[model samples]
Target chain A: MRLRIIKAYFLKEMIELIRTKMIMMPYLMPLLIVILFGYGIKMQVTGVRTLILDNDNSQISRKMILKFEHSKYFTTTVKNMSEKDALREIKKANIDAIIIIPSSFEKNSLKGIKTEIGVFIDASFPSRSTTISNYIQGVVMDLANDFNINSSGMININTRNLFNQALRDEEMIVPGLIGMVLLISPAILTALIIAKEKEEGTIFNFYSSPVSKGEFLVAKLSAIFFLVSIAIFVIFLVASYLFDLPFRGSFFLFWLASEFYVFTALGFGLLVSIIASSQIVAIIVTLMLTIIPAFMYSGMIMPISSMSGDAFITAHIYPVMYYNHIIYDTFLIGQGFNSPTNISYLLLLFGYGIVLFLLGLLFLKKEIK
Target chain B: MKIFITILLKELISFFRSFGLVILVIYFFTAEVYVAANGMEIEAKNVAVGVVDKSAGGMSKKILSNLHSPEFQTPKFYKSQKELSDAIYNKNIMVGMIFDEQFEKDYYKKLNPTINILIDSTTASQSLMAIGYIQNILMKFNNLELPVALKMHKLFNQNADTGLFMGVSELLSVITLLTTILTAIAFVKEKESGTWDIMLLMPVNPKIIILAKSLSQIIIIMIGVVLSVGLILFQSLDVPINGNLLHFFILTFFYVATTAGIGLFIAAVSKNIMQISQLSIVIMMPIIFLSGAWTPIYAMHPLLQYLSALSPLSYYIEGCESIFFRGTSFVDLLPYFGGVLILGVILYWYGFRKIGKLF
Candidate 1:
């Protein structure tokens, strides 16, 4: 609790981090995550490779094929291939789907006799296939409308996307990536630094010194918390400038929430360091706890509402999910601390920080066992 | 040869002795795989919807009735559009609909009555799919007879089960992560424990030592893969093996070796276990991202599509999928094998020399 003792420990931790060149990690990790996930992780399926077998060889069939070609969802190549060959192409993983316009397709369409356009989709990846089928359905509907098929009823549905108008995947992914990167890098760094002290027997310096366990732990956490807070700011700028992420909510509110979340993450690292006997074990344990949950249950790849049973409960228990909500709400929904629900989420983050810090302190021994 | 076996056995023994790491490996291969496969729902399920039925008419009620369980939760009726909008903002409901008073009357008069559907698009996949579902319901209400019917045959995965795909994909990602970290730590641990000098002084080729250590970790990871595939993918999730299981294992072997090369390079440069974890995340994440494990390759930007070719995981994932789902023949599997081998040899050689010189 002494200020002088805390300062000495903090300065020592900082010097060690600088000597190991670990200072670059806070900046480097976020940039890497943003660039890789921002540009790389796309949920919207586009450019599905499609092969068309147009047996009708008529203008109507050609026009139908053109519709598929023009649509952003598909890249169509028309060829004189048989059904068997097209199936072979799909099986070889060469193409994603096949469109077959039979020889009688044009004849039947012109006569108002209902015909069928056969679609063979490679459903190896089920989600992609579902999206492909939806796109194909849309294209077919557009074609039907053009032919004056009157598919539209007396009732029309006008759909509007509220938060992300264009439904850009990055809008969802970048903000979530910020939460993910911040959690993993700081946690791993803090865990490894403490575990290294134990492994190298340097922890005896604190064990034999006048520094209380609380002061030592707090000083270590503060050093990482300080550096990572700066890193978070840099990441926010990167997100806003490089990714063009709009910040619609209160900046002050978001900043306060971030500090709490960072503290919780660092405390989790502290707990892992105390439990692990070696630096390698600490890294592995930290990753095992943080990475999978953050990716799977934090609503990063899958929506939390879509989860059921144990998964839903798991999502609620993790601090990452709460932080994920804050990120999305602030970045996309523009809802800040005004919403009572958002305030609750912020408070939960603070609670998790306090709980994790107490847990780490409780486990940290002043004398080596 | 004797030196290699001795070091290999020593490495394996030490690995087994670490009870904490052993338990973690088991948990990752078993419980982690199980939760991911069973938990993640890619297709839209239980989409919470709210509606303001001002019309209170037959057609509006009929449309509301169409929104049913599994795909959607039964629609909750709200008094006004503002209330529904608030519900959406609060994320209480993903989709909200407001039916004007003229809705049913206009429909009867053959005047197209528009229903305003507001969607929260933060969870893009769910919202997009939900939109499609709503449109279908409205289209059915339109009841317009079309000229042509589009018949879709979903091949490979007839039921569109997300679990089967997710389980296998998670297994692959776990493989990449473990192989890289395990191999890197094997080398870095020796340095951290002040045993690197002793390892160098031993009467053995540095090449044999590095090969033995890295291979030991890969062997451990391969066993973890087997457990995941057997217990989680096959037994629990019922993921089918359409092609020869041997082919899947072979492709995995090449992949593990390739990633182990990256781990060796990481160990060569990193001074501690912390650097190993940091460098692994920096290096491994991009490979996973570009591999199209989470995202479909076709959906990525053209430049990224081109860049995916350089990632060894892209080939491994494609090969495994083709083997499992498509039952592709060995002849057609050559390109995947070639990609893995070519990449593996270059990486393994570079890392082998990098660490060998230090010796």
Candidate 2:
């Protein structure tokens, strides 16, 4: 009786998702996010923008101007421009910012007068604006030190992005891209499976058919499991070969962890689809259920522990915690976290995945009507 | 006016009928407020740090002891930069402090000895705070180095920059995006349930129906805003609004209108909630990523820098910072609001055409 009932629901779900346009259409979002982010994500701050309004006209001011002109971060867009022109340049955003050495800056410096060398920045673009401000602050401080009269001590920062020795964007983004795709694995399948059945009017047929519910559930979920595995394998190849993500760990271990993570994603996606009234609701609920918490708390970029207690707890509830661990170990670090603390995180996620799959089973049962 | 009021009431009833709607509201509030408090804000308070001192000398000891003590969140120590960097990558550590040898010698002779500080700039807000703390410590070092003749004028509030000041702005942006997205979800839900057709067959024009739906959603969105402001006030999560509260609300009004219009557009173009939701993610990704939430916008590609200008949330965040944190007046904010107004009008116009086709 139980097997027949489960199979009845399983076939019912599979038919509905296959027919639903709304549910099926979003298979594109994960793919698009992957392609775009693969190209976009980077850490190294480039295009350090600086505008020039040099009024000194003297050899010293001109020479100092040349030093500002050719730096990795600083790019001088304009010169010999009036204050109006400079302000106009700011409004037009002709530059990220402007560096104005007053007409008598050289004279004042030579005379040991504290003449202000005004560096006007376009604060509209906050990050670049802030970057422009910071780099200029450093360069101007260096110039002041060269004078030795009013020197502000320069502080140098050296960065070593630990696991990622190279600190390449590809390594950083490709893993995130893969996680993002896998995160959607179960969700897309779950979303479409039931909706297609509902749309195709095959849900009634499943109920009439003699197949046991257990066998039916097995078939419906097996199809999803197979598709999800393919998606994972595809992402792995892309991350490994196309994006050239660093793979120092055993591929088998990575594959093992990923299989476990995919099961969790599928279970959650199934649960989401079960609750939804239509394909649209299924997708939105699933995305929110998976993406928001994962993106925020899964310790992918932001440390979940840094957040408040409740938020921290919520992060663990999503599959991102385990899947992200798998990604980090496989892609960047080359091995799983050797410490028990790291291993515990993976175990905790595995436990949560089981719970989520159970929830999917229960919710699917409830939604059979 | 009476007809509009009736339609508005009707729409409100429908929105309330769906428990899903209220659940979404809760998600928006919880996620935006709580997440923003921890991650989105520019304010970093009581930052936890780890400090390592290999140099066993007196000056190094002083710096280490200072960092070791609870004054600066009692920084942790690792054997080397390698271990510390690994901690950062694994999210086990937030900041790393290393004091090189000859620390005092370089101070007196002006050798400009570098005090290396490693921070995870992924959470840009916290990283900035760590950077500020380092600055404060170093500034103290500088004061001891020089004879201390000149008193430098503090032109700006150095600590008040983005951390606490911009936290509210970031929260506002997040809340606004989620609200508009939720409202869009309702429209798509209507389509999926076949209620959209029923609305279309009514005596009212489809445009009026859309307006009524949007207007009802506006009320719901404002509830979220009120909740956020109330919580911020209670929690004191951000620096108090320095500029003007009334102006801040006024700015929120325009922002909501623009987002609502955009949501309406999305609802009309997309067939169902799932499609709209997916598309919404696509639209919101750049807005969130390039908005300087996690990483600094200046650090992004040039194309993204210019593209960020098109994001209404960007203007809203800067404006909120100006009013609430920076204490800038209405005239100072005209430029930001002007940009928002222009974008809102253009998006509204474009969305209107799209909605017409979809409806």
Candidate 3:
């Protein structure tokens, strides 16, 4: 438990980290993920390419095709290919959907009869196909209402989108990316430290020395935690500036919360490394334990509330879930820091950190014996 | 040929002796199967919304009543807009809606009265779909008369099984990642332990050694693929692979072969296991992103769509999806097979050349 020994170990780790460029590698990950997910990974489904085949070729059918063309969701074109060719292209995934207006479409609609419009969707990707189908339905309904306007009752519903008016995927994606990247980088950075030492036959130095396991673990954790926190702070600034992210919460509270989250993640990493016999096992285990859960159970992309039984239970146990919730709250919701629920979740996150570090200390002692 | 067989046997023995590698292989399969079965769903269902109705009129009531389950939970009534906003801020509800005082009056007068929706945009995709639901409910409430009926025919996946799509795509991605990583690790592990130089000193050709190593890795990866596809995806998850089974495996072989070449190239470049792991992420990220496994290529910018051609995964995902969903025959899948084959040959040549220099 010597302070001098711990500080020396901390400095040694810092020098190694700098020499290996490990510290610099993590910094790149957050930025790459932010830009890639922000610009490249578009969740909003738009510009779905659709082919419209018209058997009727009537003025009414042309009007229907025009409605689809005008939609923001669909980029529609009237392809004059035969049904077989259209099906081939659809199977080849050249087209997302095909709309066929029946031969008696105009006559039936003019006679005030219900006309069945055929919409064939390539449903390989379910969500996209569902969106395309929904868009088609909306357009068809709009056309139907237009035809029966004199006898129908239609109310224009003006919908107002609050907070994120544009609903930029970046706004939401950036914050979640911050949560995921911060957790994973710190955990992995700390995870390989002890395992690397053992693999290189350097652990015998510590075993022969007077530095206690607690002190050794603390020294390593603090160094990696410090590097990771600084990296996260820099990433936060870059994300805020680069993506124009709104920072409405108190900066101090956000920073404090981030520290606790990083400690918890690093502690988990230390725990994994302490038990792992080899660097490969440590890395693969850390990756599987942290990255998958961080992506899936942390509610980064999918809301925890929406998860079913097995996944929902898993989410509640992981510390990443609480951290992800805190990030979303502090970044987007901007509720005051003193809120009881917010405090409770943050406490739970700190609790996980303390428990994990203590567990790692206990295991290291047993391994020494 | 005797030297190749000897090298291949040694590689296989080392791989089998490592219990950690076996566990990791098992972990990858089971975890993917679990996530694909349970996760990969983004559809908003039973979303609880807070409502503030100032109008208290027939139209407002009708809209509220129309909100039903599988999409919306029973709406909780709020005393005022402040309460609704607080609930949303606290995450007690995903969304908050406020109906204006002139709701029914404006509707009858053909003056559009706005319904304000405050969404927690952190759940981005769900919020977007929630908007769709609100719009659809409004459309239903508005157009009570007969409209032109739309008959939707979902050609491939009729029920729109998201799990099936996610499971199958994940299977391919996992196979690609595992084969590449394990092969790279195997190559570097020997170098790190000082056995690579010994092997290099042998009279065996470097090409033979490389092929032997890749062959061992390919065999193991193929077994994992079969177990994942057969036990997990097809049987456990009930994902129907509609294509010819033989054609799919042939395509998978080419895909895995291309990755092995890429892995060998990485091994030649890296100095240690740590470096290999780091480089793996660097190499794998771009492939996964551009592969259209998670996001559709049609959704990407045209430039990205073109750039995706450089990644063999892009062809693999498309070809696999076509085979699984559309049941397209082998000859029709010539383009995908050729893409993987060409990339494999090029990378294999480059990697072998680099290894020759390393020795």
lDDT of each: 0.87, 0.62, 0.81
Best-matching candidate per TM-score: 1
Against the true structure, candidate 2 reaches a TM-score of 0.73
What value does the lDDT take at residue B201 in candidate 3?
Answer: 90
**Which residue pairs show collisions in model 1?**
A153-B142
lDDT of 1 by residue, A283-347 (tens): 77887898778888888677776666788899899999999888888898988977887899999
**Residue A5 displacement (Å), model 1:** 2.4
lDDT of 1 at B170: 81
Q: What share of the true interface contacts does each candidate keep?
A: 0.82, 0.14, 0.57
True contacts kept of 2: 0.14
Can you tell me the CAPRI class of model 3?
medium
Tens-place lDDT digits, model 3, residues A1-369: 789999999999889989988777568766777677666666777888899999899998998888988888888888788888888888777888999888898888788788887889999988877777778877886786676565334555445455456787777777777778877777877778888888887888888887888888889889888877788788788778888888766677678778998989888788888777677777888877877777778776777755657888998998888877777777776774856767888889889899988888877852354
Candidate 3 segments exceeding 4 Å error: A145-158, A366-369, B53-69, B98-116, B138-140
Candidate 2: C-alpha lDDT: 0.62
- How does candidate 1 fare on TM-score? 0.96
Instruction: Tell me how candidate 3 scores on lDDT.
Output: 0.81
List candidate 1 segments past 4 Å from native.
A151-153, B296-303
DockQ of each: 0.70, 0.17, 0.54
| Evaluation by DockQ, superior candidate among 1 and 3 | 1
Candidate 1 per-residue C-alpha lDDT over B193-297 given as tens digits, one digit per residue, 9 for 90 to 100: 889999889888888999999989989999999888888899989998888899999999998999999999999999887778778988898889989887777
